[model samples]
Target chain A: MGNIPSGINTPEILVDVEKLERNIARVAQRVSSQGLKLRPHAKTHKMLEVADRQLTAGAAGLTVATVGEALNFALHGVPKLFIAYPLWINESQAERILELMKRAKLSIGTDSVAAVQQMAKMLGEKAPKVKLMIEIDSGHHRSGVAPAQAVEIADAARDAGLRVHGVFTFPGHSYAPNAIDEAVNQEHKALAEAACLLRKAGHQVKRISGGSTPTAELSDNSVLTEVRPGVYVFGDAQQFELGRTGWNDIALSVASTVISRHEGSADIPRRIVVDAGSKVLGSDRPAWASGYGRVMECPEASITALSEHHATIDWPEERELPGYGEQLRIIPNHVCVAVNLVDSVLAIHPDGAVERWDVNARGLNY
Target chain B: MGNIPSGINTPEILVDVEKLERNIARVAQRVSSQGLKLRPHAKTHKMLEVADRQLTAGAAGLTVATVGEALNFALHGVPKLFIAYPLWINESQAERILELMKRAKLSIGTDSVAAVQQMAKMLGEKAPKVKLMIEIDSGHHRSGVAPAQAVEIADAARDAGLRVHGVFTFPGHSYAPNAIDEAVNQEHKALAEAACLLRKAGHQVKRISGGSTPTAELSDNSVLTEVRPGVYVFGDAQQFELGRTGWNDIALSVASTVISRHEGSADIPRRIVVDAGSKVLGSDRPAWASGYGRVMECPEASITALSEHHATIDWPEERELPGYGEQLRIIPNHVCVAVNLVDSVLAIHPDGAVERWDVNARGLNY
Candidate 1:
């Protein structure tokens, strides 16, 4: 609709403000209307500005993946922070968590009893203040204790003087083709049983947290008090391919320029190289993800392959292809990993002006 | 072989200095014995310390992938830097290159005539001083012009007042399973023909650069003036799988701590979850690569899957699985991508001391 900044760099992250606001409001409305607390995961954008906007839109708190990520948000005065993924609290991380706990209400996820014990010993007397949520396996089977085993871990956490929160699980298996509804059911069943176990153990199960972008809409919110979907705020190609969101719902993409064009032989498709590659767009092609990333304008083109600095998009024989220096918006397969690949994002306002936001919590995997 | 730093952070990059030195020496000696210059690519580690070590080990110059990377090395007083990438010269990047050119002798890759014209116009009078390497297709077909068409682009570069030095081709296709020898032959043929084309046009073909870690040793130096191998100094799982290096050659790995251990059913292998995942190790499996990465000590444990913050490793029945708090060294599938994912790398000295070296050129895709 308008010209980008003349001096803008290629292979850069760009967020359409209008679309971003719409996506945020839409998710928040659905969660709030269902009477569930919305704690959008910060691992997607890793920007404090995005967190602030979500908080402004009635997010209960922010959910992160690591202690370093939580520290980034805590430094910016986000009072309530939750490290949703199960973490093995080491000395450096525990010390950092101690500093963060003094500034904010912190919560962490633990899957194993030994990890809970180590966390308690690492934090010493301050462990009680930090809320602990036992992650239960909701059929994903990646990380998280079984629903039947949640009571033992919760009891052990309480014995170690840790504040036991309810239970949480990531319905990651929802990402597979035609598996969203089943994953949602599994998440609900897992959290419900895990919370029941905590309640039977005489512990207050206040938060039965569960979600993922694909299953957030299909989730049985009655069984959970909160939903934590990270990718819904900035829909990616994986979300689009799964029919979880429409193309209009995609807010973030890498603004890439056509760097080279190679004429293919009769048997091969015409190879069009773009500046954006794995380094900028991230290589997260889950079998179903539409060809690395979708070219927003050129739907007919299939991105055949990608190297570190070049994306080889095979253009249809009939469709007109872009020449060198032409720019394209690439909706990456996984927006979270793509955002982590950049230092900052260019947010283009409705008025067409752009502002760069620092990816503050980026590379905070520790 | 020794104790890891207990107080250090998890999901961190660790470089064994002794192993790293050995790798550097090995490649340097091989390249030197051939009477061909070695310009190690900085995209692998992107650290000043690594670049310094490479230069001290008799590397003629350093090769980088982007202008932002070149600027990082130039600022550190590296006398010569070659950006072996077909960069789309934008206004901001051109301005940055102008500043870098003032600091170091700069050479860049160009495959198209339009790109050459744009680069020449950006540099203006100083364009003649910048050596231009015409990229030729060597079966990879990712980027670069065909070997037969190299003279047209080289002549166009010369007409635009750019110093047409020679030709270069990346045998990137060598990374595939059992494709190294074929890719090497392709690279040699492409560079030889392209250099011959340039020389026929009365241009002095002083340099013929070609290499990739997989085909570096197999490369015919009689047809090439120099080799640019980036991953040799930090052998990854992909390189090891291709038989280019051994486990002992893998000097860098993500020092990740076990966060969770899930007991699997009879059918499923025992799952060991670590804090390091795609974010720390990078999402570059290349289909044929060893599942995500490899656990150095637990060779029988294969990393089955990786989410943003968790690496789900499948420990074979015969192997002894790790405990909840034990640490493992994860040699990533692609060391370059893994190094770029971090802010700094931990250099573990022989004396048991560790120092963090900043990944200065990380996220410098522009």
Candidate 2:
């Protein structure tokens, strides 16, 4: 896509149409050719247009992080959705899921036997059948049960009158540098083990799915039937730093104006302050991740720190820093977090026309 | 207020009426007794009801961070407003500010002579007189000009036919563990010096304001004519750790459900995973902050880490960890950010009635 004009609002997410289409097609082709289903995560973009494009590009379904996101997509006529979170089925959520099941084929992740039993009780007799996936631990140490324990939860869901649809896990450790290979290995082993255990327990394991953006290339397609990657459509600074992608693959960036430029000593590193801060880019600096974000134009320049509404950048000494009112595109460390910060984004098409796309599922954590 | 009913929603902000009233009255009394104007930052709650309470409690005006926030407050019938950020005055922002001035008395912050000149150009012929304040650097080193240079911009604004309204600064560096005293001293020195310079330049300094939540109590009221402290209304983990607030002063928290509880090994601490994550609490962990947020029921229990939709809490060994489906209140690291994360908050009244209050200016980042 062409460069964004300065007429629109600053500190806004800008989608480059050409790069987005290419990124969508690329991931879709790779996953489809490997005989694996492409179910791109809706938590990344959450825009109906982007979801339409992914579905049109051979995605089998959409993966969401919350029930509200699933509802948002279902309302827009997405046929299939999987809420890939170990969610607590509260009364309101269970009732909403019952309504959502009428619109789309609903699948949810469950890590506990107690939650599955509660969901079953809430669903009662008249509810439609819903698929359940056991969340298996893939060495992320965040959530999910051990691979050996996955069959127990899957069995519990099946016993409670829910359809068991196999297992899934997140390779969250892959976000760090030098950890992609290890995370990929963990994903393959955990998924394979979970599938084997579930099948032995008399459950028909149809969908054994696990894949993050960085580990997708090394994913064991032989055992997996589906791949879910969110950030591949919008390559962030974290992915770029891990050598998972280059600048050309970046489809989305935050367009920020240089509100103030600071003169600094050598120790401080000459800097410029942009309007985009933690409120826009998000405060998600993993200890292993360097800087806040990478500048799209000059990857050498790093967003050193962030206040509420100001991003302080440590510019390179070799080049001149931007002046007041100069706009720059910033690739945030986490695209999922950055996309949630704004209500809508300015899409700069290849032909230079701009359109707005609302983040329909933003702030839908409940 | 009573404990949040489990029937509402998870990862939602809950406001306690009893504590909220106390916090508001306490700040209003302290600022009024000291002969300083209490214009608490509206960027914290962004709710009209909270602004109404603050105004009724004895606030002179409301302080906002952006033009959008200013307009939001103005439309809510707040008589006076101040945009306490060195904002870039684009044509659209200028038009909005001009429209807002018709509804309320408005003032804006400016740091650079270039920006002030540009503002004068866009706001030239037909616009009414708007107050302009020069932002003085009070050791934050983020935005604002030097204390000595404040007079130059104040003079330029005056020459450009705008009403010159003194100087202000933010002690943002006060968020660290032991830096409150130094930051308070810096705020006093900078605001006092800037006022003196403006007076020396034959300009009347009506509003010499500077105070963050941490430094609000330690401010030298003799030097400050007004103070703007946002997070005081909803005390957060950062304030509680810095000894700026007591546990009783915390009026707002996120109600999250324990989705899964994990048994730990030697390296992994005993943990419970909550549904409230960075998307709800916001990812604003300062290096000095102990954890992502604090458990309201057990302040010692720290949120060890966070995913996009899950807060992993490492509970204290001595205390019992919450099991699945337990609803717990979470005090985030930064209240300002957490407030911006949600569209509406569940306000628990003194009579134990819970009502929804819309965050009117949630994403007014522009």
Candidate 3:
């Protein structure tokens, strides 16, 4: 796997080794200079190697979305993990969570009093109690209780004998370009208000966590102790659209081959079909995305549409079309989902050697 | 692993062993009765065990969407694998294809003359003499040459010394209700016309294949020698919405736990958040789909929207709401993409025994 050449593989994920290292170094340096904890979210690159790079670069901990993700990272010896999503604790899953806790310091998020009570019942007589973070709905009307109702849930969690660690919120609205500043400000206010309420209720509120990739840039570290920005480690289309990262900073691309071609008549420009399709690049065209995906070398050529095994592209008439059977590289709109869509990524080393790394956590969605 | 109880585990994916076996048996019987080869597309299950079951049940061959899928199936000793995608063959990939042909009977689809010529150049003396299938566009407006133009490509494939096996098309439009009849009819017409054109050109057409799960039941098998249907084994929300299959026929579901319960307001109607998000279930909401996803047991409930790590459901106030930490099963809109998003599936046996089968081809999209 390590001896293979990077450009030879078809429908393979290509991670620009240099760009990835630079992105990790930049994020780690920024967070460290601010005297804040950097818990890079594993939801973006659910790979142990990426997590190892972050930890080696001085990340305080790792942030994961599922108990399975936490377990994967913990098995690889990542000491501190935060299951950032509000977890549903059942009798069966509780046993898995307990096992994860035995390996690493675990903190889980919850937004309901019933969930806290359920966890308490499941964790009855356990040596170390699971740390709980109350999720507050800052601006994103998705999961999480309202900031005004945060105290009630915190009180309930504390009463259930679960250690109420702090309040956390995801400013998901920040993903939108115009909403970043507003979302971050709202997150600051929501976390501050929730912490004040929890403190007034006699609960020790230590950590105030909030920040997604879009919001992390503008987030006020003065209020929050930690930031979890997953996509920052591998800038994607969303980052490019939001102006969070430049086009050259994108580290991942899908290497595909031109399978079909229809030369331009007087009416239609040259149309080339690439083998990379929804299954390879992932059919994630956000409403705001320009196209299905963008071409790395030929940025002007947009991936107009995607079928199960075909990416339709309209090449400009002035530029010579890539001959059929020619290999082309594509930079996906959303790298996180694209990475999840492939089994392994071709890691191009600085010395021009290619190593294939199995996305060990590729499909551990459960 | 088979000794464990299925219900005790979390509800991400539930395998009804009886229903799965019944599905395989029913499809096999139908194909056998029609005197057509049954090459079940492994894209739906992506599991080696399921592929083995289909083959053991007397499947003639296996169908896959990518070279990686073909390689994975070939590794499991599933000989005679057809890569149903019109692959873009480059020099580097041609070598790999030649390598793959050594282990299995490799057949690939092509819609362009340039690709065929490229394969001819790369294959050289040790070309493995791959079988080529011409793809015809039957109103899907996706890949494949038009029905009228497929013969030209077929002649090119033959001229290049490749075996022109058959013509194939995907009736992707059959995914909507009242669309299957028209789509399948178009498929029949397209394949017939393509076959006739090839025969007129003094070429032997051994097969005429086309059938997706949506139109598999209604497909006209008189003109076709074989039919490929992937999702019939695991009916999903799309099948239910299109009226292709009833809810009772659905054999796969995502098991999720109610992690958050919004219990404060009567107007809210007890909203519960599950861990299944777009990443897990896939953000596939077809225009005809009822919602993002459907609750497996509570068919009336709808998954209104999905965040990265949360599924927001609006529960009915008339009935008792699912308690926090209560487990619920969800059927995704598209099962093929959903199954590919996970690493392994828990196979629940008839007597309630659970066995985990690695989705050996889960993300082998390359």
> In terms of lDDT, which candidate is stronger, 2 or 3?
2
What order do candidates take by DockQ, descending?
Answer: 1, 2, 3
Per-model TM-score versus the true fold = 0.97, 0.97, 0.91
Q: Tell me the fnat of candidate 3.
A: 0.57
Q: What is the lDDT of residue B341 in candidate 2?
A: 85
Model 1 alpha-carbon drift over 4 Å, by segment: A1-3
Ranking by TM-score: 1, 2, 3
For B1-366, candidate 1 gives per-residue lDDT tens digits of 234678778888889988989899989998888888899989998999989999999999899988889999999999999999888887788789889989999999989998999888888887888999889888887888878888888788878877888889988888888887788888998888888877887888889999778877665578998999999998999999889989887899888888888668875457899989899999888777669999898876788899988899988777666888898889899898899898898888889888888999999988
Question: Of the pair 1 and 2, which is ahead by DockQ?
Answer: 1
Q: Judged by DockQ, which candidate is best?
A: 1
Position A193, candidate 3: lDDT: 89
TM-score of 3: 0.91
Task: Supply the DockQ value of model 3.
Answer: 0.47
Candidate 2 is graded, for docking, as: medium
Instruction: Tell me the lDDT of model 1 at A236.
Output: 87
B213: Cα error in model 2, Å: 0.3
Q: Which stretches of candidate 3 lie over 4 Å from their true place?
A: A1-7, A32-35, A125-129, A264-270, A316-318, B1-11, B31-35, B56-58, B90-92, B125-129, B263-270
lDDT of 2 by residue, A1-366 (tens): 469676766788899988999999988888877878888899989899899999999999999999899999999999999999887787788788888988999888888888788778888763327778888878887788888888778777877887887789998978887888888888888989989988888988988888679877566468888889999998888888899877798988888888877677544347888888888888888887778987888878877789878888888878887878788988888999999989999888888888989999999886
lDDT tens digits by residue: candidate 2, B1-366: 359766877888999978988999998898788878898998999999999999999899999988888889888899999888777878877788789988998788888887888888888863327778888878877778777887778777777777787789989889888898888888898888888888998999988898779887676568998899999998888899999989888999989899888777786567889898999998888788899989988878878889989998888888887878999999988998898989999999888888999999998887
